[model samples]
Target: MSGIEYHVSLVGNDSWEGTRSAPLRTISAAAEMALPGDVITVHEGTYRERINPPCGGESDDNRIVYQAAVGEKVEIKGSEIITNWEKVQGDVWKVILPNSFFKGFNPYANLIQGDWFTPKGRDHHTGAIYLNGNWLVEAAEFNDVIHHEGNTMLWFATVDEQNTMIWANFGNSNPNEELVEINVRQSVFYPKQSGINYITVRGFTMRHAATPWAPPTAEQVALIGTNWSKGWIIENNVISHSRCTGISLGKYGDEWDNAETTTEAYHRTIDRALGNGWNKEQIGHHIVRGNTISHCEMAGIAGSLGACFSVITENIIHDIHVQRSFTGEEMAAIKFHGAIDTLVSNNRIYRSVIGLWFDWMTQGTRVSRNLLYDNYTSDLFVEVNHGPFMVDHNLCLSTDSKDMLLNVSQGGAYVHNLFMGAVSILPDLGRSTPYLRAHSTEIAGHHTLECGDDRLYNNLVIAQKDQNGLSKYDSAAFPVFMDGNVFLNGAKPCIHETAPLEADWFDPSIKFVIEEDSVYLHLTCQMDWKNQKSRKLVTTELLDQTQISKLPYEDTDGKQFRLDTDYLGVARDESNPYPGPFEMIGEGRMVIKVWPHA
Candidate 1:
């Protein structure tokens, strides 16, 4: 009683806290009484309630934190035994970012702060946490970890139908929205229903993907810069099993076409008032890294809304499949709609309709050191748009057809990559067809540079499917600098230096195993040239018959692999392991073990 400031025991019926044994009964009472630097300890138990408070003032620092005792452990748990209808309001909900947790909660009540429904199976229209200056880390305790097998489950009880969990609005059409910064980390956040901004979420896991809460005319998840939520960092998170995009940054408002154009076109339009629409000049800096996101119904990680000066690196994103239930468009993995000054590096993507699909935008992207494998349609699908991009040191593998690696126009640099795809082409397409230039440009008398200022060097292009083992396709105008590649049957230069290594695996039977106890695997292949590499890096392996493999391989220590297995997985490190040919490759490999079903 002398040193203890206050205590709240949900189990006790006492409303007063005069004695050490007679503590406050409710957490709400303890929060009101807590002053700055005051400690409020919650005993281990289940407290069913929804929590909301006003935004934090600058002068107030009376942080209400829920933590384990120095030697004793306490648990605040969600009730897993209740039905979705019964689990409403009581699963420990909060309005702002409060340091709280359930040490023993298995299926706690839904954490709603924004526009969401409640557990009574009613549309409660409440969000989980308001996320102002407050910081929230819904961490798992030793018991919770053991109960969940050591990973935070963003959403449980796989609803046979689709569902949404987290919804946010970054304030409509307010340029000053960037001033508000919110960081949501080390937890699992799901059901991001609408557009948001100025929020940085890292080391989190997301699931139960739903359609963007925009009009059918709006094809994107959310418009990023309508009200500039600048300085957003969506890094080191596992965003998976969603129906739409993994992460969409940098977009503007509605333009000419209303309905389908907005719903279907994930392009960056230049709003005259907004200064070149959604370019690097408008949006602030962004960093999206070390995430493993897959099973999206649409594109994996897309950047439209004119996101500028952004770096999307070291993420494992794939399995963007189109479902019949998805009545919209086919799914794409990594799309650069109207982005600029972007560096998309060190990612592994596979099993999607389109991988690295670039559309209309001024090009200044440095897309290098990525591994793309078995992209169902094409690995690099460039459209009518053009740029001054630098495509170097990437690996592309098992592209099913002859349309995998190419540009709609010859602009960006194509250097040092390993590309493997089908080689059989009919004269209907013709030999003079250019690989770097699109068919629309090739058929024209003399096409202007789609977006010139290009350079090519040290790139390897291989044809894994040609019976004659030819790497080069017959084209009228070959891409510049087609020197360092090798063809399978000595036909033309298709793939680069390690033609045999790529050709040997061209039949598509080789696989990199990621055992259940195996943590994660840093599977990298390097070519002979200065910065050359094999492109197709796939994460389709199944570990322990239950868990699936994705990308960014989490943190590594030499051969040890630590995947971003769950929502709260990505941890920062001082060094990077995969630095390129001249640099170190898989130097620090860490192992990650996940028992999802256990």
Candidate 2:
């Protein structure tokens, strides 16, 4: 044979020849006997089993590849026992509980019978029977049940929560040495424990228990590696109705530690003092892409700390129904913390607290081409310490109180984004004295902008009427220049400073004193300046630039003429007919000369 091929058959109907007609008994036997580069093929049937790597065994050097038949279906199930009350005392039954525990269970009365612990093994759910931790029980058949025989409980024994399941090494907490991976593709892994890692699960259909103790407690598919394995990939899976995220990467270590003062302290604390915390020492370049995550309690995808350089793209994440008590932590469809070089693009995120949230410390991040619609808060929020960002060409639509698109206190280029349905305008400080200005604001809608320098161009924004024109508190000043823009409805658009004057200028003397939205010019003649009686002649024939005698006003220093008028709210100024900066157009009787003075 090209490589060691081990065949496993759960039905026991096949022969022992290890071929199509004959296969072995269980997957556990195939794993135990198979060497590196071995292919373990299992027949179609439900096999209830658990996989415990040889103690202190590092399987990194050994690659075990397992697959089912091309068109056949196979399911490996765990055991489940149906019981009314659980039999355990002082065992901390009321310990770490999900929100569901508080719903029906009473702390003072009635001892609850449930699987408070998950066992060590790769438990699979197939056909009618679902696995509950190495034990086979039908969950889709029976809603409430706890079945366990030959089951091993997997939990943290010490007072330290991070001290849960040790990886490959016996006592050493290094991630690379004890990396455990569970690869389940085109299969089901339900009712799993919290402490799982280095898992590559793709193209699988997973279902949750009707009444399990809690959701998958730990990271569903944790791709954790300490200075050893750098990353893992979980792509193209249909995950829904889990208590937690469809796929979780990295580790969220314990919050408290007393290792600094104790003689015998946990390694997690020692690592924390040494510039690492719990699973924080592990570095993973995890990629979760092209997955459909919906109907979850929290966001569709979430990354914490050690999750760096991960790209989440082209995923349709919708219907994230978060409760009011989700608090500050539960806000975005995709939430990232302490992440670097992360790119979130070509995704649709809608109807969440915030569409895409960048939290903690993020650098070298890019958020582009995302369609965020009808979110309750700001569609895109870059919070805390995040910098060197490039966000562009995203469409954000919202009726919420915050901006449709927004950036806060961070440095980046915000441009070419269409803001509709009451979006806030980005602050324009492009020409402020000293350093170049930055445009910081959350954006909703689709338009493209330059990367380093923030410039908004070619964006179509349909906004509700700003009844007050513009807010007075906004102090940033910009000259009103209309170009390449179209405004609809009978709405008025004005800049942040004082409102535009609605009245007309009457006197040439007042034109210079008062600021007009439009430029004004005052023209005068030599005859009018010398002879005071000729002032009326200049005012009446101001439309006739050819008729008025040309002379320089004192203010013009003998080169230009100034207009004059005081009786009525009108000004008449003479201009050069030979074409100066100002041109007077109109003729005799009904003549009206308009001057555009530069």
Candidate with the greatest TM-score versus the true structure: 1
- Error (Å) of candidate 2 at residue 545 is 54
What digit string (tens of lDDT, one per residue) describes model 1 on residues 1-598? Answer: 1223566676554468723488777555655565434455656554433212111111213222322234333322111111122222312221122123223221123332111111233221101122232111222232221233322221122111223222122222121332222212212221122222333344433443222422212334421111233445565555654434456653433453232343123221233323433333335356677777775544676655334566777777777754323322324677665445567777777777777876544244567667677677778765533334556556666447446664554444454454556433221221111111111111112223322222333333444444333333324142332333433322244343233223343222223344652223232333322232432211212111100110111111112122212111233121321222112223233222211111
Which residue ranges in model 2 land beyond 4 Å of their true spot? 1-199, 209-229, 255-274, 277-282, 322-328, 398-403, 422-459, 464-598
C-alpha displacement of 157 in model 1, angstroms? 18
Q: Judge candidate 1 against the unseen true structure and give its global Cα lDDT, from 0 to 1.
A: 0.39
RMSD of each: 16.5, 22.9
The TM-score that candidate 2 achieves is 0.46
Would you give me the overall lDDT of model 2?
Answer: 0.36
Show model 1 residue runs off by greater than 4 Å: 1-198, 213-219, 222-228, 252-268, 272-281, 322-330, 422-455, 467-479, 489-491, 494-598
- lDDT, residue 560, candidate 2: 24
Please give, for residues 241-303, the per-residue lDDT of candidate 2 as tens digits.
433344454333334421132212222222342253223223445556666666444456665
